[model samples]
Target chain A: MGKNIFRSLLLGLVMVLAIQLVALAADNQFSGVQITVQMQDHSATRAIQKLLPDFEKMTGMKVNLVILPFSAMKEKQLIELASRNATYDVIMLDYRDVAGYGEARWMIDLGQYIKGPLADPNLKLDDFLPTGVQSLTWKNKLYGFPFYIESTMLMYRKDLYDANALKVPENWDELYANALKLNLDTNKDGQVDFYGCTLRGLRAVGYNDYIYNGFLKSFGGSYFDDKWKPIFNNENGMKALETYIKILKDCGPPSVATFGYEEVMQEMMQNKTAQVIDATMLGTWLEDPEKSQVAGKNGYAMVPKGTVQRGNSFFGMGLGIPVFSKNPDAAYKFIEWATSEQVEKSFINEGAFMTRSSVLNTKEFKERWPLFANLIIDSLADANITYTPILPEWREVADFVSIAVSTALIGEKTPKEALDNAAAEVEKVMKKAGYY
Target chain B: MTKTRRDNTPQWILIPTITFILLLTTFPMAYSLYNSVMDTNLLKPYLGSTFIGLGNYFSLLQDGRFWGSVWHTVYITVSTVVIEFLLGLGLALLLNREMAGNRITRTLILIPFMTTPVVIGLIWRFLFNYDLGIINYVFRIFHLPQVLWLSNQSVALKSVVLVDVWQWTPLVALILLAGLQSLPIEPYEASLVDGCTPWQQFRRITLPLLSPSILMVLLIRTMDAIKMYDLIYVLTEGGPGTVTETISYYLYVIGFKLFYTGRAAAGSYILLIIITLISMLFIKLLRGQYQEQP
Candidate 1:
């Protein structure tokens, strides 16, 4: 009787081993495939690195991630993509670049895989934020999938506002008024001892133009018309630029002309400046006790509303398969795994940003980020994807506008004059590009 | 050896070297030359990047911003090279004497020169920062008015010059020191016997003998100053409304940032021409002075 019982136990063990082997075979279809992905260093990418071993194991494929600093990543990606043989199977793309890359035919269109036989049933593409999805779409075809997104918001010193009995600003006028009232000379020096605010005036597309575009859009002005003619010299655009210049020049730090994200964040955190109207991701850093001095003393609000609508400029990053990729199928599989619900949910504590609405709409997410959760969701809804022109010549156009903004702020030219000159130059660029 | 084999040996050996050099330098220069003449905008294929025959060059010539950058480049080059020369000469003369700790101090002064240009730029950028920088903090403590070293349009370029001088004057001084040491003791002995004063001796003998080294310094520094984009990138980024933008920085924006291939190529070729002309002019002037001096 004992010998018969031992035989039965051995038989049960064999049955379990066979069942697990069959499941592994079914799941690991691309057992020999390998793909490379080039990405920028971000919290999300860091989290993905931690979670990457699981992806490689589950898919039974080798994955190589090449992370680089942002500017280097952009330049290196272009160099690789522009070559006949792109080494990276997948690459990170800025939302503004989707149109350029699509037009160049450098990136493979992912719409077919999203809808075709390779499509994962559990992969809810519809769950991504519509703003992100819309930004990634070019000519009605999805060239990429959004990975991280940020929108413009207002961050301010709550303690300072309370001490001065100042209400939170709701619109451009109110923001300007608050800045003026908060502009203090505590030591009675002619120079402002305590600045009211700081705004980035660094002359670059990704620097000053990012902030200035919001004001222009909120005023119902635009860089170009439907026909691609320069329209930012209009009355609304001029007024927006003028107001932006006045606040920057009169109420900010003496070095306000040079302030980028780093300077602005430093000033706000060190309590040298009272407020900054900038990116949504900064809210996390502001509230972190270790990284910020004004941690508990900070307040969050939407970007100030303009006359027609509030200006919430959207910025997003996405991933795409290169056109020259040898392992397109494997590349697609990797990206799918990267953007899946499980991966996005892991970003909750791993990284602070997510592109999916499902991940962002959870009660847990709202509870975790009590300050920015609701504001981010609302701003994402209102975020203007085309706040600045999203064309291939966008860098050139944005540079012109940023320089104009700087000159106007420094009293070298009136806002109207600066905008007009920029408009003329932009017109020349458009005509040269055959946009006429 | 057979004439055929003998002739073929040198040609065969040089073929790879010649081809490599051509590929390294001439090919890109020629390619840029070709691109400069076409309407080669990669982004706008609709325009059909056909042969436009100097359209980019013409536009750049007429471009005010382009001219502004050219002027700024000249200004920065002159300012940096001159300041570096004066300071370097002073340092070199001082170090030429027999003194304690001369060797160690000489080695230590080279520390800045040994650093990578990008790292040097980043370091100076922090020091020159207006709000959080030690420079401003010190000024505050001493009751000195704080100066916006980099943010102010007028002072921005000067601050760039200051950093360049700080990092490079040591190199210039070292180069001149070598020239100083190599100088014959006869000229100083002769001048001493003639009862010539120190200033007169320096002017008549010391300077004329050091002309080669001085020429070397001017040439290297001018070329280097003309290519002064790295510091501007980290410090001012050609900011305060394009007041500090040099030709290299402007072309960088045009080429890498704007991606206007043909226009950027034209701008690059224009810069190459400017650099070559200035270098030629410098060599001619220095050599002329050297030959003409009694």
Candidate 2:
């Protein structure tokens, strides 16, 4: 009877202890805490949304993810930030906008959180591409964490080129020649059924200027001098305009002037356009058999060289916690988790291109996206961001440039006339901004 | 005291609605007016804003792009309103007559107006596409030369105007048809007894009586067309080198895209002044027409 009583008492004590431990572990760490994240509708964001349940479970915090179309997202974010609204705790920012956003102090200085105890050491900040990190830094202060880095490259139909015994174009001259030779009228309809190439010609600051700057930089033209004087009206600038118009008008599709990324991508994937010069992210889409008719027949190469140099435009999208966020620490945690190596690896497996070197160089990633891996590294080596000025007034200037280039493309004005007019407008904007 | 209390009841009932309108409309107007006189650029807040009275307005007058956008707006508004009025009036006249399928046709015509402007823009953009558009395919079948509807600068503005006409012409027609139905039959019977031709009856009686409806449709459509943004934004985005950049679209680019709040505010005020003047002119003409009739 004494032994039975002792055993029963010990078992009850052990059960009580076990129940107490379970209650402690299940306790809400961030109960009642909610953070809203504003991001563009992209594959990466979709992947992030899929993993957010895990985040909520771990921290006991709620997340409100607001995804919007690309253009609408930028406008909404700008409005929210400018209004000093704490509505969005986290925001997705294009690297090009960092200068403008950081200068306004709209985003929190993330250096502290990055170096503090909240940061995971495994993130290995140095593993991010230098260009991606550099673009997101303004005045030597990091404002955001890198999401994905992108550069422009040439995407072409390999079967068409190989069957025609054509070598990949090395320079503008060869590009023009190859384009003209490959512009075929398959049904002899007198109209070319296959366009030589399709490039972004939409007259928007982001759509047209992004691709045109690559040509501008490669042609040895600069947007502004060291003192911030507009110099794109110079000889080289005019030459770039002339060459761009000539090639696009002569060899491109009839409606190339209205084509943005979607139109260009669709045309190439449908086997309607023989080549395209666009963002590096397009390679993955082009290789997807479900969306592409020329999947295995596609070839990747560096952007064509110009008279003076060969260059690529570097850009990326990053995530930043807004200065108005009420839950800064929680927001930081989410950013850290979302951009971690393990999460980025999964993102890569789901076909999201990431900025981390480890993600791009991993054996599985390289094998799955070999073309993109090779092209991204090669293009990053020669990519330049100077073409699109990293100034607060850069967007205004780009608007004028987009109009000038588009007008010239449609044969409305001579290249010199259009560029000079745009230069004058840019000068006025700069003068008003006190850049004189 | 009781009579005064009863009078106050209406004011009390109206207070909430009046307050709502003032909050939604007057507050934003006042705020924009204040912002217009300040040098405010959201992206350059470090520079800070200063009361630069009339600075933004002065710069706008000197800005060529501002004037160019104004010209484009006026051009598009005039072309769309004029064409829509003519086609709408013609359709209204035809539909007013006794016809077998009038009911179905009336309902079918409302489809375009029922559709969203952005969706209409997208559908038209695909139809006007140069390479793979069904419109071009039809033209090829007929051996007619394909036109670059959205690419060529000369035709891009016209294409946008065409889209506006397609969507809003039905609304105008319906308004006019209601006006036509309400018109007395005595004048037409008298004209027929006097051996008057159909054209003479339409000009002398029908047109004079229909002037009020015509003016009403004109005022509504003109206002909407002048502030048009969505269709243009989705279709051409003021492309082919600002050939179609309307004033409202320019204001949007300045305010949202460039974050030049001060300049955009000034631009909006200028547009407001223009619209107000146009409305006053139309109302004065409408009042004169009413007085002249009775």
Candidate 3:
């Protein structure tokens, strides 16, 4: 697997290097074009914004930015897409949203633009992470290009692990054992000072349910069968949920069910938790010396597995041109420029979520982010996109499952009861959509 | 009579007003009603808006989650309104008294209702956080068990109700206080001259005179409470297994997230009817009280 990754890495480098020279000499054709782009107000997007002036200078095109929080951004995009608004030329593209947008034909098919003579060779498609590129493609046509990608990974306190003479867990059993041993009571207080584990239990598709997908895939449970029938209530799913509940109840914080990504990450920064298994993006916050109490004292590893051999999640966010855009060529130019490797490298200190393999291979990146750079690339190389299938109804399906998982967490329903109910509802949704 | 009034004076003034009103109000209702009878889901673009009369309603009636949300909405509305009425009346009566700092106290009472609902939800969410909230912190300090305010399903709806009550009781109290200030002093003076107790005067005169305002409060609060969405949307997000999902929240999920526009419109009409019936009940009661006295 490592050798294969290396070969692809070499091929991407050669392609990028060959194209870089050709792209730098290309003409700025659409100098007067003004394009507005909408994006989520996230750390990476803020970092990307800093390079907007340079792009403006290089392309001689005016760019407008409309940034909003995640949910609001999605809602706004939906409203605009549904109404066929020409207000935004370029929009932030979530990999999960690719199917919905593509099927709706609300996005311009970038496969046409990203390849052949129309393509900007410096756009460097091969340089983007494999899963990142694949997730943005729908029905064998490329719809967008990911500029940032992250996957689930284990983040733990190195001091605690070393003091206990523990090795990083490779599978579920070892993880559970370590959690048990690390549930510590310090300061001679009867109450536990440091929790052994914490995972989000907030009832939202993108919150707790995001992490839960890793567990589901690890246990050999798929959300659907070969024929698109809901089968997640099977024994494998129940086991996955049962084990999830066991970890949170036994070693997590008392308010684990109220935990979201922000809260779990907060617990780590406050030194109240020993470990968390969440998106690799969390490394940026947890390793920040100004914000974190445990900065530079953390260990990183791949997300532990279950009885099955597969598990970690890979997802991405990118940019795409709206179908109604007046300046499709200019919009594509902006996307290509924004995701280019040079722009990605310039904003590394702000914890830019790099998309290019060349950036990952940089010695500066490795030295600066020693905690997560290596582990992230390793996980990315083997990132399993099939763990969470790209369906047009993903938002709705994942939301239903999230509610069920939350129900089990709060002791309102058993894992079997909740998962079974959710499976039935999801099946109904599929039937209603004529997917049966 | 004044220049015979018919020469070139346009009769089209009412046209613009009528058109504006209909576009603002009637058009959406008509469009949604039309959608409710058809398969208008955006997700299934292939399945065009085919006329499936009563199909959406039939499915909604059979939908277990829809019914659960209806029950949840009723629980939140009834609990918050009832609790707010009782507490609000007590507050109105107290403020009606000639007590020290009464003016300042009255102003302070308005603070909760004056704050935006979203901000209230955010503040209360922090205050009710199970591990780190101020309420739980105080409970820990007092050696009392911490409550699962947002996490536990059985308690979540009640927590939402409590937040609603906290934010709205002041509005109810202020309305009742206005009614109290407007009450005639003659009956109470007459009762005092006749050696009647304060309770007797209040029970006989004050309550009867305040019935209209009380009914008004009931009408407004009930309609507002039934459409409760913002608070729970930010607080529990219909969590701990759909326990706190109100009818409006469920309708939102169907319309926006699921894109089952037909089902959502149908479900919305059902909620509209429920609100209409409850408002009519309050209005009828108010009419009867006025008829008896007038």
Candidate 4:
């Protein structure tokens, strides 16, 4: 009778413990709420999705994903998020858009969630690249988690460089010389199949802002002065632009001025160019043999020095939670988990770059892919993390400026004339919009 | 206009229909007009907007890009419709005759017409890519001047026109084919008996008979071509130095991309006026034919 009673009591205790554990897991798992994320295609989406099983196992939270093309995703997400439908629980945002979204109160102020010494003991804020962690903040308030932050650097074909007995260019003059040498008529057909270098000069938003802004910043020209005056037409800015345009003409593909991100990617993939200044995210595609012919034959280097600076590449996108989410607490929990070092390791295992400093410098990751790990970390660390000061007026300013540049490059207008015209139009936009 | 009084029909049906028209059409038109007078940027909705009255319209009048786009729209609309109408009429006549495999040919002709504009634009964009395009491939095959199809500002409009022709010419052919099918065979036989040549018969009798259908096709195509958006948006997005920027493209840039609601509204009102005038002119041209009908 004593043995039977003891056995029954022990069994009951075990069952009670099991039931409590299940209830605790259920509480963390989101109680079956479906959180949708509107994100762009980079290494991050696959990495995040890879963790879904584990997420469900640990928290019981189910994540629904809707990944869109980068351009389409931005337009659709902004329209939906701005209208306050909260259709997306999480969204991918660049530093430039953080201010706009934050000011509009579209994104949750994640300061409280990520504050007080990193919320969760497992997830440390200091583990992230300092700039990347800082980039997600607007008005000194955290609004996003740094997913896969990126900036541009010069990528060249190592095989091509060795075969031609050439060296990496350090400055504009050296770059021009290298470009001339690399612009070889390989088959002596008089038609240049392999161009020296290329950059996106297309009128797309990416080209207009990121690529052109890279050039503008490299020339030591800020969009606005301390008082927010348009400095795009300043002397250093104009000189930088002229040199950039000239170099593009001499070095780039025949129709590069019209090439967008996709076009530049094609040129690099086909090994038709000696070098290209593109986002480090391209390393993922370049390393994939199926995606690139020059896979494993590429070398990474810092972007060439311009007249005013060495390089002025900027960070791209990060994961953000919208403010109108019905389940902010659950969303915050998921974010903390996703941005954790464990998640970063998972991303590295799946061939994705993580913005976390802890994962980026790990001995294991460095051994797997030294150049990629270095390039991403270096760019994110050194990049100009300031959101474009003219972010609010960028949509209109970009179009007007691109038109001017296009005209000048095509020889329809002189650089002076083009810059003057563009400045006039931009000034009018600022005045009408109450910016100036 | 006479309002039809119904006896058996319910007034509620008209009520719903009228409400729908007001909601979908009239309300938007009124809203646009109101927005045109106010300097509202949808992207910055919190900013206190000021009423600018006719300032936006006045500014648009002086805007060079606006005028350039207007000219581009005219060029595209005129060139595409005229060429398509001619080609379409020829195809319609050819199909009207007893020929081998007419059913298959008709179905094949409808394929391009049935494709979504976005898909058509993407397909053509790939086909015309200067670097890795089939059109350039064919050019290499035939030893032709490998034209910079979308890159060269001077020729981008022509490239877009070519795509428009490829897709919409079939529409014209089908409509004209209907008109050709409905025509009496006796008139052609009588003309043949009178020693009239094929060209003469076509010019005198067939053309006169086809006038109503041709006018309808022209008017519809003119309006559509004027409002052209999807294919152009997908293909070039009014790129390569604004060479292919049409009125609709300008409006989209101003409204959606640039968030200049007032300017876009002003642009649409101008477009509305132009379309209305053209419609009136077409109606006047077709008045005599309709007057002699039932």
lDDT (Cα, tens digit) per residue for candidate 2, span A1-436: 9999999999999998885565456575554579999998988889999999888777767899999999899999988888899999999988878988988889998999878988777878898888888888999889888887788899988899999999999998898899998899988978787889788888887787788888888888999988888999898898788888888888888888888899999999898889999888779899999999989998899999998777577778888999999998889888888888888888876673678888887887888787767777778767875557898777789889999989888888998999999999999889988887
Off by over 4 Å in 2: A1-28, B1-7
Question: How far is B225's C-alpha from truth in model 1 (Å)?
Answer: 1.2
Which CAPRI quality tier does the interface of model 4 achieve? acceptable
Residue range B112-190, candidate 4, lDDT tens digits: 9899999999999899888789999899788787877877778888999999999999999999999989988898899
Better of 1 and 3 by TM-score: 3
Model 4: lDDT equals 0.79
Tell me, by DockQ, which candidate is best: 2
| Residue B74 C-alpha lDDT in model 1 | 87
lDDT of candidate 1 over A1-436, digit per residue (tens): 9999999999999998875675577587776577889999987898889999888778778889999977789878776665546699999889888888888888888998988889899989889988888898889889888889989899988888999998999898888889888888777867677788788887766788888889989899998889999999899999889878888877888888888887788888887888998888778878878878889998889998888889778899988998899999999988888888878887786545778888898887788788889898888888879787788777678889999988887677789888999999999988977788
Candidate 4 segments whose C-alpha is farther than 4 A from its true place = A1-25, A116-118, A350-352, A387-390, B1-9, B292-294
Docking class of 1: acceptable
| Residue lDDT tens for model 3, A267-294 | 9999988899888888989988899999
- The best candidate by lDDT is 2
Candidate ranking under DockQ, highest first, comes to 2, 3, 1, 4
Residue-pair clashes per prediction, in order, are 0, 0, 0, 2
State the fraction of real interface contacts model 3 keeps.
Answer: 0.49
Q: What is the i-RMS of every prediction?
A: 2.1, 0.9, 1.7, 1.8
Two-chain DockQ for each candidate model: 0.44, 0.70, 0.47, 0.37
